[model samples]
Target chain A: MENSAIIQINQLIKRFPMGKGEFTALKGINLDFGTGEFAGLIGPSGSGKTTLLNIIGSLDMPTEGEAVVLGKPISKLSSKESAKLRKESLGFIFQSYNLLQVHTVFENVEFPLLLLDYTTAERKKMVMDALEWVGLTDKVKSKPPQLSGGECQRVAIARAMVKKPSLVLADEPTANLDAANSHNILQTMLNLNRELKTTFIFATHDEKVIGYLKRKIFLKDGLVDHEEWINQ
Target chain B: MKIAFKLAFRNLIGAGLRTWLNVIVLSFSFVVIIWMKGILVGWDHQAKNDMEQWEIGKGQFWHNQYDPYDGFTITDSHAPIPNEFKPEIEKGEMVPMLFAQGTIYPQGRMQPAMIKGIPANQTLLKIPTHKLDSVTDVIPAIIGEVMARSSHLEKGSRVVLRWRDSKGTFDAAEIEIVDIFSTTVPTIDVAQVWINLETMQEKLLLPEQATLFSFANAEENRPAVGDFRLKTKKELTAEIDAMIKTKSKGQSVFYFILLLLAMLAIFDTQILSIFRRQKEIGTYVALGYTRQQVVTLFTVEGAMHAVLAAALAAVYGIPFFIWQSKVGFTIPMDTSEFGMAIAPTMYPIYSVGLILSTTLIVLLTTSVVSYWPARRIAKMNPTEALRGKIQ
Candidate 1:
């Protein structure tokens, strides 16, 4: 593995119990992702894109192989260790923009930092900066229910990027957005990736998301079929 | 832990009426349990205090043969008053009483009764024994209200009294009722009559003899008299203690049921919260919380309802309890009908220990019920939960 590689997978297999039989979500697959890469796992639903992303994010473990994230084996990490990795190094974005509905936009962005031991003043400054990046400074006190779909997704992005984690796993981040909103979100993520050098791995089949990725790994039936790199 | 508290507080506050509804119900339990327990404590104190004042004067010494429960023993119960108690009696700290089996005919109806002779000038008990000092051709006597009602007799009414003297000879005389005293202690009130000690000693031809002696204060380390057994205040009130214990046991079941109703509301709310907040659970997991941490968060959230309820209870319960302590609680039924020392109106007594212990019990029970349902979060699949799937 190169020094720049932040995530490395070898013969990764993920299976779930279906009735009395086992259903393979991700077949034996090998993949590597380097730092500062804007990448997406492109495939239809149930093609193991999310399964693989979950494995890399340390939310789920590989069944038959090793998934190393930030030099920690995903399959071997204890629950506490996995939580620590997620808290300190990895960020996750969901398709539905899973902002804490009862919390203000500022509180949602401050969630990840609360897991760490940041001073209150440090957290406040960092949250304001992240919200400013997403152009949501005016909506800090607004709760998710009071915001539009586009604004909610922006808050989710601010929350994921608030800690300036080395890796961010976004799953179908644009699936619930309109075309204009999707473009706006993708452009913001792209600019953050270039400026902060933060590695982003997205599990999405949305063509609009695909058009903005620096590299695309096409997955077919739980296998990597092809890979493409786009010129900036 | 700090973050858990913070988030739990936010979640509880955010839930709005659902949270307050459970809190109010639990708060009602807190107030009622404390109030009910206070009434029992007050009754216990009142009953014991009344017995001390009206009947048992701190302690007593009984002649070995005297048994208050058996009327047959009264005929042989009297002896010459002990010389050791003479000084105390002269000092007005002790009073001697004599007892004998007797019969009364009121309105041509006959009834069995006990005739007691107490010093007319004694102040050891609340009874109006001075009424017996009336000088008249007919002997003056005092009886409790219950005895008066049973004999169809009233003040100033004359009744024929017959009794066996120490020599076993029957004597009869007409006695004038001097007074009818009301008392909570049935032992002092029911089926009894009182007369002047000097007059009774002369009538029975047993001068300077008494059946029992009551003292105004407990005397510790006193030498035992040869023919009498000393009874401390605690020993004298043992029956009342036993009765209160039995009553307290019955009361426990009521508070338990009351707590169960409140706990059911909290448990129901917790179960509903877990079902409805799956996505929030998932979001917490994705935000770097372990499943156990999420369980802790939910448990804390549920437990916080009790904290809020306690505050709410104090808001109203303090004033209500204070006012109750002053105004007292009146039993709807006649207390005299209960055939016990219960007063018609009982004032509740509140102690810090009682309030704190009750609060702790309810708080612990609420937390347990809350945690019982929240444990399910630890087994949830985060991936599915994030999608808002029912697990």
Candidate 2:
């Protein structure tokens, strides 16, 4: 089955101005990820994978062409509108675990919902539910500093899923973890994707990370070098 | 919003040493500004008080200050006291007062001093109310403690005083010291003598109404009695305050410039902070925070530091003001030109306006002083913010 497209990019370009010249980061690219698909964007250093992720995440404006996610043409949204969309529809996970270090595991998971002005009781329920999904309900009171690598990644996963967004964008989420920790975190994220049918998109250079995904797109020097599907 | 505050609080603790250092610097700046504010206002108050009491409204009032001749006639014709100015002299508030240089001869010792004669009814000179009631004889005098001590003369002891009379001529008299008094202000308490208005009129040998005139106290609550056109202490103070205002014309601009300088420093610190923790800011952005949300976090962080510092200062400063209010601060007599007779016993009058205005200034200074860097952090592209960290 070709899972229905959730994101589409076409003729995308990004340029940077040096003192007297311009450097092109993304010359042109075309790609698509289907609904409920676990996908990885892989590239070498300076290959512009992170740049592509930023554009797709609505964290940046594209210099040219179209990058659309979840039926929203991100480039067309005003800054405030774009921010609202991200808050309501997207989740993010980062390599550093990005759990607010001062908060307990429960608070870290509940942090995004706080911005939504949910009542305390609702927040508790949602956060606990997310923690359970990550097998971290027992560590709800623990701060990030107290957690091991695998547990920290689990907390990050809990935070992302707590918002219950349609899509999750992760940038090098397992880059800081050991091999076993990376494998465990990937399995946990894939398990959540299966249960919730949420789309998961990753920008990474790790072969181990790429192997877990059902779809893969590889970029070389800002151009799409290959796009493939596995076990479909 | 709660997450913003929580994150801000966390950022402060996460960089404990730097946060504390900012607090210390901020507190020091607060103290310096407040201390300067107190001293300037204190000095102006002291100056005005002395002026009203000593009969020098704006600057020194001259009983013929410009006239080279001694004891010149102040008639309605020759050195005319303006007819319009008469009611001021007639009223007790601006009563005619005279000054003359004299030699006081106690036995064989003679010392040169200024003898001032003021109306016994006028309380603006700070003659104690109880003592005013006790002054029964017109020819008796209030001699400075320094003069009395030097002369070895007690109250009721008679001494000879010689001076040039109102007509540019010489005159002499023998009078008893009715009161020997001292003021913390050294200028007035040393080398001086005070006599009743009538006594100095007699000694200076002037006609019944000859003396220089100035308003007693402009800050007083008294209504205007008549055409008393004497310069009020308030008018004099207003002039002086206006002059200082002109001197400090661009103070707000200077404050802004200082705030800018402070902002630059804050930016350097915050940028260094952000640089040192590049991965941290990147992590926050990646974790679903908008640029505005990030800015709000840092700005609130800056405000918290400012408030914390001000609160600490207030904790110490309020009690200091209270102690100062009850006991008063005594500036030494020798420190000012006004002399011991005019020394100020300053009691700090607390005003909520002062505290509130000062706190706002400090908070604004800190926030404005710290905003540039916060914007820098907020405006950063996520790629640049996460540049070195994602690999």
Candidate 3:
């Protein structure tokens, strides 16, 4: 494996129990993700993009073969060890902008660092900086219910990047946002990627997300068909 | 743990009216349980104190044949006063008494009574025995207010009293009521009459004799008097302790019911919270929480309701107790008919142990109720939860 490879998969297979049998989500597949790479697994629904992303993010494990994230095998890590990996080295953004509904915007953004056990002062500064990246520093006290869709997505972005983790995995992050809000959210993520040199992997079927990806891997029915690198 | 508490605290506070509703129910339980337990404790204390003061002194020695509950024993319950108690009796540290079955004719109505005899100047008891020294042509006798009312007699009212002597001869005399004392202890009152010890001995033709003796100082050494059996203060008040224990057992059912209601509210709230907050649980897992950590967070959130409830209880309970102290609780019905020493209006005493134990019980019950539903989080699939899917 290359020193720069933060995630590596070896003939990975994933299947979910379906009635008396099973349905394969990701057929035998292999992939690699290097440090500081801006990448996306692009395909339509049921094309295995999300299953692949979940494996890389350590939220799920391959049934056959290996998925090594940050040098820890996804299938072998204990529950505490996996949690530690997510806490210290990985972050996630969901499509629905799943901010803790009752918490203020600041508290939502501060959630990652809270798990990482940063000093209060350090956590406050980092959270502010992350919110500033998304231009949401002024809405610190507003809860999710009080915010617009665009603002809530920005808060989710701030939460994902607050700890400056080595990798961030976003699954259909723009699915619920309007085109304008989606573009703004993508721009903010792009700026964070360039500034901090953090690796970002997105599983998306939206063309708008595809336009921002530096590298796109297209999946066709649980198999990686091909990948294309764009010239920046 | 500290961070979990902070988050739990914020979450509970953020829940708004839903949070306060559960808290109010739990706090109400706190106040009511404490109040009920306090009443029983106060009753126990007051009942024992009254008995010690007006009825039994430090202790008593009953003649071998004496049985307070048996009327047949009263005829043979008398013996010459024990020699060992003579010095103490003279020193005012002890007093002797005797009682025999008798009948009274008051207002031309026949009534059975217990004719009790005590030293006119005895200081060992709260009974007004000195009133027997009153100068009157008729024998001066004292009765309790209950007896006075039932007999329709007043101070200076003369009534016919008849009783059998030690030799089995019957005699009758007119007795004047000199005093009508009031007391909480009914054992020494109700259908009873008191007169001078010497006067009773002369009338019975049996000098230097008494039924039982009560000592003022419990620490004084008592010698064995073959004719009498010694009873300690503890032995005499053991019944009160046993009675209080029985009352407490009955009160425990109320405690259980109160706790059950409060816990049901909390348990319902927690189930609803866990069901509705599936996305939040997913978000927590994605943000570096283990399934176990999420479980702990939810449990902490649930347990904190008790803490808040306790705070709310103190806000109202302290003042309520203080005000109640000023005006004691009035028994809704007459306590006299209970055949025990219960004041019509009794003051409740709250102790540190009672408050602390009650707080602990509520806290623990709430936590257990909270944790039961939170365990569901541990079995949830984080991948599905993030999408807010039903688990």
Using DockQ, give the best candidate's number: 3
Question: Which docking category, incorrect, acceptable, medium or high, applies to candidate 3?
Answer: high
When 1 and 2 are scored with DockQ, the better candidate is 1
- DockQ for model 1 equals 0.72
Docking class of 2: acceptable
lDDT by residue for model 2 over A122-182, one digit each (tens)? 9999999999888988998888899998899888888888978888989899999999989
Q: What's chain A's TM-score in each predicted model?
A: 0.98, 0.95, 0.97
Can you list each candidate's DockQ? 0.72, 0.44, 0.82
lDDT tens digits, residue span A80-128, model 1: 9988999999888889998887789998999999999999999999999
On TM-score, the stronger of 2 and 3 is 3
Clashes of 3: 0
Each candidate's fnat, listed in order, reads 0.56, 0.30, 0.78
Question: lDDT of model 3 at residue A38?
Answer: 89
Report the lDDT tens digits of candidate 3 across residue range B1-391. 7778989998999999999999999999999898888888888888888888877788888898989889999999888986788899999988888888899999788999999999999987999887888999999999988888888999889999999998999999999999999887887788999999898889887789888888887864565586888877788888888888988999899889989998999999999998899989988888889999888888889899999999999999989977776687999996765668888878789999999999998998888999999999999888888777865
Q: What is the lDDT for B319 in model 3?
A: 95
